[model samples]
Target: MKNYFLLLICMILLSCKKENKKNFDESIAAKLYNKAKVFRNSNVSDSAFIYYNLAKNAYLERKDSLGVGKSLVNMAILQHNKQDYYGSIETSLEANNFLRKIDDSTTRSTLASSFNNMGICSSYLYEFENSILFYNQALKYVNIPSNKYLYYNNLGDVLITLGKYPEAQKNLSIALQTKDSLKYATFINNMARAKYYENPNYNPLPEFYKALKIRQDNNDLQGQNSSYATLSIYFFDKDKIKALDYAKKMLEVAVKNNSKEDQLQALQKIINLDKENYLENFKKFQALNDSIQIARSKAKNQFAVVRYDVEKIQREKAEKEIEGLQKNFGIGILLIILIGGLFLYRKRKKRLEQEKELEVKNTQLKMSKKVHDVVANGIYQVMTKIENQEHFNKDEALDELEFVYEKSRDISYEKTDNQGEEKDFSEKISETVSSFKNDEVNTYLAGNDSGTWKHLSTKNKEEVYQIIRELLVNMKKHSKATIVSFRFERENDLIRIFYTDNGIGISGDVIYKNGLSSTVSRIETINGEIIFDTKIEKGLKITISFPAS
Candidate 1:
């Protein structure tokens, strides 16, 4: 009985120690995180990163996911400020993974923040589509007014980059409605930029000045630098003096903040706008930019090494967890392997079946094209000849119809090769034009004797033959004309075909329906160009150009 009582006392003591350690670690992590936030706000990125990482390690040791996620958020922002965009994205995504595992209002807000960081990083990397996607995702979970300001402002900026000015303006306006001074400055500045891009002649200077004034009053150094930078760019082509003034101000602010990147940008603008001092400024800008780039590269490498160390630690932890799972369930592991193999085999079989089906569909599409060009065109020509003839022969009609029917039935049939068979390719083109000749239209052909036809491949010639034949058929059926002309010429490496008709042209803009749309698709397939012109008073004019090869 005494031994049992002693054992219970021992367990109680251990539990108390564990609880005390948890409370102590939590307090230390919270203090570290608060210090990191202060450092981050001051733009002391290196100090912020050190405290954030320290807090992150403490949180990890205590198994506090929320603390870890918050620390990662600060770390990611530090990396982003350092211009380590790829590393920022990685850290933000890791934060998101942790924050998402705990479903709560606070965690959801943290996840939204992670997504916002991801959007900013993506925008910096020029992945506009992914940036927009991440911004929208952030917006979806952003319930806080402060977070809304961020989401809407960022969304507007990205939309501006995408050239969706109206949408950008709308989003920026929404962000402004939140009535936050800092947000107001940012949104107005972005709105000014959007308006400037929407119309070059429109003056966005008033809005720019408003944002600048607000930022200056708030003592926002970063915002002031941004305003100066934008103002310099805004006045660059309009007023050189104002541009140089703003550039100088930007340089002043950047130097005060010790922001080398901003200094480089300001110097570049000054060099561009200050024509009198351009040569001197150019040398200064070149020297400063080179030095900054080297420093930045070194800093980026250091940050990347830190991130790699963090990743390695996480990977080690993951491997340990996986090892535990493997040891705990040997039979389950064997079953999983068998199931995975079966799943892969089935997936492969399904993919092969899909591929086979796609092949068949593609073949059918090709066959349909053949039928439209060969059988359908043949029938249309025969009908036109019959309509124009004084008398129609029944045997000739039957023979033509039977030939088309047979061609339609043969699924394995190949298109008749016209290579070497047509001793004169131009003669074949001339014959195609003559087939459309009627009593009402006087058809003419020019440049048909050019040796340009020899330069085109057999496939190209066949496509040309079909295209010209289709055009002629359309003219015959729809064009009520007195004259039609076909002219083919070669300019260097391009074959140009110009067709003009004296027919009563259709009214207004030409609407390409079935036949013309198909013609366009065929021309596009051969990487050709086609232009059509039709008016009430003028007859239709069509020009086609394609490479000889």
Candidate 2:
């Protein structure tokens, strides 16, 4: 193949013969960027990742923060596509350093996007805390509030998932606050949901009407369908015929959207409300469910192909380079043989390097699953127990739960050695606190000196993370705090976390009697101290201090 790069260099030099200039080699990198964009649209995630890897390398070589940040965004998406939720969080965190270097508004958008996807990953894994954390983080970077409608909606969804009806409604309300009719319609649909779930007396007919009217006007097929389903549910208790009509409309929309979940849910309602119509919809529901399952697998396969293709291109490019250099060097027969040997050596060296890279990637993949599935999973399980008011001689379950989250935190943060500057630790904290925000409560993380935080070992760092996470969880359940601030402070030889909130604070007497309970033990394990600063109407502030050095 002709080297367009060389031709371009020749042209630039020829055109500017009057003055000498240092030419930049951006051809290979530009190709990577172009290919990645193509693969991303094609939905070939793995191939997309390979292309993104190339782009990342090219941009880094050129010291382009924008390019690097974009590549990281693509990498994170690929990780999510591959079901490596924990891996996506880790990669996004690594992407953060490069992102923080960029001054452009686009970088902010990129960060928001990264956080949005991270939230999805965490949510699917049932790590509600991490999911909410990422959602809140995304909210901050959405420069255009109009672009934040979906984010706020999603935030409300997670809040509902946590069984915090009031909190969910609050978030959904904000989602509609812009007064964009289309957005407001969506929120009404969501609010209908919140009321239904959290309050027995909640009636959604009026809200559902508001949603239906807006969705119908806007031609929002999905939203219209959703409103219909809610209406069906709302009328189910009163009028059977009315419920069936609404249910039929919902089913039609579900079919149009090709949404299995919605279809199944709609059909299930129809069957329950009108058992006489079951025989008809049941067949369609089963078929649709099967079809969507196959679609999911097919999508996964397509993503894998893209990954393979990207690798093939890079290998082909390297082989061509080595072969061309060897054949073009016709200075002497002896030189040709020497050059061929050098080429083979280079090829072998590259192969070894690839092996090392693959090993590192696999290790990361393992750690990610462990962190998300094992540790985050355990946290959710314990949280579920607490939320449902389940039996709590819970010492056995609590002990098992704490063990997993702490261990995952320990292993997942091996590189930082528990340093304050650790991005993973910061992210981990965000993930933990994120789940606690709801109608009645909100969690906010503030004042981290990421640029200045430097000391702490990986173990110590994770220990700090676990301690803070446990404390925050406790505050959310017990503090009755409407507003909570997760503040991180570092001084010479001392690291401190001040979890202050406008909630009911516990007295020091309670702490002495119930100190180091559950998660607090993990904090004590790391030689940490906790103090309660509570006051009337001011809420509660628990200051936790630990050794940074």
Candidate 3:
């Protein structure tokens, strides 16, 4: 009886001690988290990160995996908010692993959230294939009918970025069906935004008006601001003064939200609609963008600091730890700064180079369109007329031929710059066939009324155009084709370019002569597959299908 009483006293003392410890850790963690919030609210990212690091350490030392995961998720958000995409990816990946190990349903949304974020970052990096993969992964976790809206919206955005328009439209329509307020705003904004580039019917102006009404009623300042920004672009076509007025309204809300990122983003997009005060506007844009980016970076660093502090507090409680932890942190900070500085510098340089290239490409595209409409097609008409006229005198024909030859040579020389880099495929085909086609050939086009080049990339456009030209030349020289029909259409991810002609078909025993050998070589070089459809009187229909990218 005496021994039992002593043992009970010891147990009571230990229990009381543990209770005190738990209370202490919880108090400190919560306080640190709140302080981090205060710092973030004040636009002091560095201090916020310091506090967040402390909270992360506190949760970690307590062996609270759920808390740790949540803390990490917040940190990941901060990192992404700062544009530290690689670091954000790593943080999310780690958090996702923890979430996967946990079976609780309460925080299961973390997995889908992480995947959606990863997909967005991947799209920013232009890794379209991987972006699609991550978006699809998000769908697995967000399959619950109630939770499907945001995931499908995110997936649709990624698909659109991947140039998978049909798939994107399907996903976006489903996302809208859920009518989730935030997701609805986002999906509607994105869908309407696509009208500016890809779709012709739904102008961004009407969609923005509708979205703005909903957002204003809900008091969603961010959505209202974004819609206004988009509206600014839309109305520049009709009312410039109204567009600028709306754009200013957008910047005001972003400022009120205390979201520097949004403020800068809104300002940048809105400036595109501005016509006057160009220099002043550009200076303001650069300064504001830089300041906001710096603030976000500081906030991200603060989150990192908070996590570190929590870890240190825990280590000190458990078996005595070495005191060199802070010293090592100093060294690590310097190294990371140096490395990050170098990475940012290189990334900036690369972006500048890409912008320059894009500018040149846009110029080339404009020139090519002009040439196709004015010069190339005009020459093709002249050639066709000449072939039909059947002129009697050789001398008169020689003068006309000389004029065409000199003009065509000039165009050819201009196109040969950068090894045909500037030539549009349709223009090239028009030029090449005019040079080779006989008078009486009749051409039928199926599905070519889409004005011919809506969906083609410059490279594919050039290649496919060449393919058509080469086939026409081959038929005229050897196959004796009078009538030809060309077809081009898209299905799934593939594009099929096919042509049929009432011409002599090839025998397997005979070696490909004239332009046939060159056509086969070109197709092979492009890694495109060719199917021959030729039977006795059936003539020839060659179809080629290849991956778009």
Residue 94 alpha-carbon offset, candidate 1, angstroms: 0.9
Best by TM-score: 1
lDDT of 2 by residue, 67-131 (tens): 78888888888777655566677778878788888667899988888889889888866678889
Of the candidates numbered 1 and 2, which has the greater TM-score value? Answer: 1
Provide the lDDT at 305 for model 3: 43
Cα error, candidate 1, residue 122 (Å): 1.6
Candidate 1 minimal-lDDT segment of 10 residues: 9-18
- Model 3 has how many clashing residue pairs? 19
TM, every model: 0.53, 0.52, 0.49
Candidate 2 is scored at a TM of 0.52
Q: Which stretches of candidate 1 lie over 4 Å from their true place?
A: 1-19, 41-43, 307-549
Clashing pairs in 1: none
Model 2: per-residue Cα lDDT at residue 547 = 74
Residue ranges of candidate 2 with Cα displaced over 4 Å: 1-63, 71-103, 195-198, 236-240, 326-549
Alpha-carbon local distance difference test for all models: 0.72, 0.67, 0.61
* lDDT of residue 217 for candidate 1: 95
Candidate 2 vs candidate 3: the TM-score winner is 2
Please report the candidate that would top lDDT against the real structure: 1
